[model samples]
Target: MYLDMPIDRATPHVVRESVDAVRRWEPRCEVVRVIPSITESRETIRVQWRLADGVIRETEVPR
Candidate 1:
C-alpha cells in the first residue's frame, strides 16, 4: 500500500518514509537500506535487510 503512492522523483523524504515503513512492518529483520530507482515507465524499490542470523536478503518492489 505504501509503495502505491505517486511520485515524480525519488526524493529523500520518499526514501526515508519507505525505510520507516519496512522497519515498522517487519520486525524480524533490520533494514539495511531502501533504494528507490526510477525508470521511464516505472518505479522500483529495492530493500536490503539483515536477518537475525546475519543473512542479508534483498527484495525489489516495482510499481
Candidate 2:
C-alpha cells in the first residue's frame, strides 16, 4: 500500500502511527518507498507499500 501524508511538525508522529496501524491491519504489507514532498510551499509526503499479493497501494494526506 502507498500513502501520501502531509505533515507539519505536529503530525510527524502520525506517520509512524499510521504505519504501525496498517501493519497491524495487514501483516503481509511491506513499506517500499517514502518520498517526501518538497514543492514551493506545500507539505506533502508519499509512502508506498507492497502487499503480499504483489499489489501496490498509495494514499495522500494533506496537513
Question: Which numbered prediction scores highest in lDDT against the true structure?
Answer: 1
lDDT for each residue of candidate 1 in 1-63, tens digit (9 for 90 to 100): 344455664445667877888789988889998888877767777989998899889998876
- C-alpha positional error of residue 22 in candidate 2 after TM-score superposition, expressed in Å: 1.0
TM-score for each model: 0.72, 0.51
Worst 10 residues of 1 by lDDT: 1-10
List residue ranges in candidate 2 displaced over 4 A.
1-7, 34-45, 53-55
Give the clash total for candidate 1: 0
Q: Where is model 1 more than 4 Å wrong at Cα?
A: 1-10
Task: Report RMSD for candidate 1.
Answer: 3.2
Positional deviation of residue 30's Cα in model 1 after best superposition, in angstroms: 0.5
